[model samples]
Target: MPERRPTRSLPETLRTLRALRTPADPGFWRSPVRGARFTAVLGVVLLVGLTLLFVTGLLSYAAYNPDLNPVNDKTPGKGWLGFYLFSWPTGPHWLYRLTQGLHVTVGIVLVPVLLAKLWSVIPRLFALPPARSVGHALERLSLLLLIGGALFQFVTGLLNIQLDYLFPGSFYTLHFYGAWVFLAGFVTHTVLKTPQAVRVLRQGIPRGEGGTRRGESGTPRGESGPPRRGTDTLAAPDPLPATLSRRGALAMVGAGSLLLLITSAGRSFDGPLRRIALLTPRGGTDPGPGPNAFQVNKTASAVRITPADTGENWRLTVRGPAGELRFSRAELLAMEQHSAELPIACVEGWSTSDQRWRGVRLADLAALAGYPDRPPGVFVESLQRGGSFRKAALRDNQVRDGRSLLALEVNGAPLSPDHGYPARIIVPAAPGVLNTKWVETLTFGEL
Candidate 1:
C-alpha cells in the first residue's frame, strides 16, 4: 500500500543526521530560568530528598532483622560516621511507621525534582567532542551511574507500591545493592562538580553563551583554546524556557509533593487523613471484614488455611527462658485482656487504619511462660508456613515493650480467618508481615 519511497544509503543517512544536529545553540530560545540558579535550586531539593530516602531505606532494610547493624547499630542514636547503627527505636513504639512512611513518601514526591535536574543538564551528553579529557570521562561515568541507578530505584519502587512485579530477581536484594551503587556514584559526581556549581551560582545565572557553563579555560566558557591540564568543563544547563518561572517551578514541585504526601501518606497516618487519601489502594477496596475492616495481605485460602480448622483447632504457645506454655482461645480470652488502637503498615506502602485490637500483651505471655526479658530476642512462629515473613524475631526492646500484643479480637469481633483467626501478633511499628499473622509459638532466647 506504500508509495515506493527509496531509503537513503547508510553514509547519506549519517550525514543527514549530523547536519540536522547542527541547529542553533540553545541560548537563543531559552528563558533566563534555564540557568545555573534554577539547576542549583533543583539540585539542592534533590539532595535533601536523596538523603532522606537513603536513610529511611537503610532503616527499613535493617528492620527485617532486628539484630543486624542497620537495625541495631547507627546514628541519630549515636555518631558512628553518621550511619544508622542503633537498634531501630523501640521506645516510641511507632518508629518503623515513621521511617518507612517517610521513605516512600519522599521517593514519590522527589520525582518532579529528579526530572527537572535531569532536564537541566542532559545536553552535556551531546556536546561536541564528547569527552575533553580523561577526568571528564570519569565524571561522565559517575554521572551515568547516578542517573541510571536513581531512575531504576524510582521505577521499581513505584511498581512495588502497586504490588506489581514485572522484573526478575528479588526486589529487596536488587534495591539494596542498587542503593549502595547509587550512593557511590552520587558522592563521586558531587565531589567532581561542586566547585563549578558554586562558581556559576555566584556569577548569577543565564551566563553569556548558549547553555555554556563555567568550565576549564579554552572551552566556550573562559579562554577558548586548549583546556588546562587540571581542570574540566562545567555541565551545561538545559534550554527549557521558564514558562514556569524559577519560583513557579519550585512551587509546582512543592505542591505536587504535598499533594502526593497527603494522598499516599494515608498509608501511614491512619487518622482523619484516611478519608481524604482517595488514591490509596486500601481505601476503596473491601478488606471483606476485620479490624476497622482491615485489608488482608495474605488470605486464608491463599495460604491454604481453612476457616473451620482455624476456629476449632487453634492453640497459642509461648516458649521462653522459663518454659513452654500453651492455651486455647477461651483460655486466652479469659485472661487479663487489654485493647489498643494500632495500624497495620506494609512494606508495599499500604497500611490499615487504627484497628481496635483486643488481646494479651506479649510481656504477659512471656511472664506466663516464666521468662523475663533479656538480650538477643524471641522467635515468633506462625501456623501457616512457606511465606517469607511467616516467622520473625522480636528483639529485647520489642518483647519488653508493653505495646506488643498477641491479639484475639478486633472491633469487638473475634478475628476473621482472613485476618489471622484465633491469634496474631500485633506489634507497635513492625511491618505488617513481621507481626506474624496466625501466630503459633513464641520461642525466647533466639538470635
Candidate 2:
C-alpha cells in the first residue's frame, strides 16, 4: 500500500503547467524577452535606483527644516504635528546641494529600468491565482500601490525639475505627501518578493544550476525543501529568450539611465563632466551679472517690467519699527560692504555654484532702519508687481546672519537687469524665491 506513488509522463506534466497561467494578462511568459532572470535583472536596478531617490529625497526634505532652512516655512516649524521630529545638520553648506542633485539625477536615469521591469511583469497582472487566499490578495494590493506611487513620484518630480508647472495644485506639498505613501508600498512589496527574486537569481541562468536539476524542489528555499508536491516546474524556462537576450535588455536600460544622468546633472557636476553635460541648463561660462554671471529662472523681459523701473532712480525703502529708511543705489554702495560666497538653490533642485556676492548686510539695514539690533523676522518686497513670490518672509536666522545681503554686485561687476539689476536679496541657505529681486521694500519684524 505504501508503494503506490505515481506521476504523469514528462510531456503531459509540461503541457498541464503551460496551461496553468491566466487568460486576461498579456503573455509575457510566452515571450522570449520575459522570464525570472530578465525580470530580476531590471527589478534589482529599479529597486536600487528608487531606494537612493527616496533616501536622498527625505534628506532634501530635512534640509528644509524650519530651524535650519532660511526660508520662513509654516509647516516644519510646527514639526508635522509632532510626528517627524528631527533637525537638519547645519554643517557642510553644500550638503543639501549634493543630496538634492543626486536625488534628481537618480530619478531621471532610473526611468528606463522602471519601465522595463514593469513590462516584464505585466503578465502577472493577469495571472490566475494559484490559490485565492488573503495573503495573495494583500500582495496584489501592495503591487498596485507600488506601481501607482512610483509613477506619480517619477512623473511629477521630472516635470517640476524642468520648471514645467502643467499640473495644478501645490507641487511641493503633493510631492512630499506622495513620497511617504510610495515608500510604504515599496517596503511591503520588497518584503514579500525579495526571497523569490534572490532564489531565482541564485538558481543561475534561466535553465537553473547546481542543486536545481530536473525534478528538484520547485518549492522556494525557506519553505520545506521538497519537490513541490505536484509541480515539478523547472527552476527556469530558457536562459536566453528567442528574441532579446537578458544582457541586451540590461544594456538598453543602463544606457538610458546614463544618458538621463548626464543631460540633467547641470552645474551640480564639476570637473570635466560639467563641460560635457550638454543638457545642463545652469552654466558657469554664461555671460551675465549674477553668480557664474547669471542663471535666469525668470527673465526681466519675460516678467514684462521696464528697465526704467529698475534704473537710476531705483531706491530700496525699508519700513521698520522706527520709521521708513530709504536708500538710493549710490548710497547703499557707500555703506560698509561685505561679500560672501553663497549658492542660490531652487525648489526645482538645480543649484548654482557659490558665487562671490558683495553688498550691504541685511542686519545692518535693519539696524539703520531703527529696528532692534537683530529682528526676529524680515519681509522682502520686489519691484515685479505680479508673481507668486513677489514678496517673501525671512526666518530669524536669515535676518541675523551677516552673510545675508542686499547684494549690489557679483564677482566685480554690478548686476545685469536679468540678474536683478541694482540689487537683490542674497541670503545663506535660502531658497531662490526668498531672495526676491528688483528690490523695492524691506520690513523687519514679526512674520
Query: In candidate 2, residue 11 scores what lDDT?
Result: 96
TM-score leader: 1
* Model 1: residue 161 alpha-carbon error in angstroms: 1.0
C-alpha lDDT score of every prediction, in listed order: 0.69, 0.69
- Write down the worst ten-residue block by lDDT for model 1: 69-78
What range of 10 consecutive residues in model 2 has the weakest lDDT sum?
Answer: 230-239
Looking at candidate 2, what is the lDDT of residue 210? 30
**Predicted candidate 1 versus true structure: per-residue lDDT over 1-447, tens digit per residue:** 989987899999998776553413332224444555667777777777898898888878667653442322222233332354355555455667677778887798788889878876654555556666786677778877899989988988887777788756667766776787788888776665555466566765424344345444323343122343322222322345346677787787778878877677665554456657768555434444334466778877777776666676777877766777778999999998988777777777667656888999888887777664443466887888566666777776777777778899988988887788889888877777778778888877756
Off by over 4 Å in 1: 1-19, 22-33, 66-85, 198-203, 206-255, 283-291, 321-323, 372-376
Q: What is the C-alpha RMSD of each candidate to the true structure, in Å?
A: 6.9, 8.0
After superposition, candidate 2 runs with Cα above 4 Å error:
1-28, 59-91, 198-244, 267-275, 280-292, 370-375
- State the local distance difference test value for candidate 2: 0.69
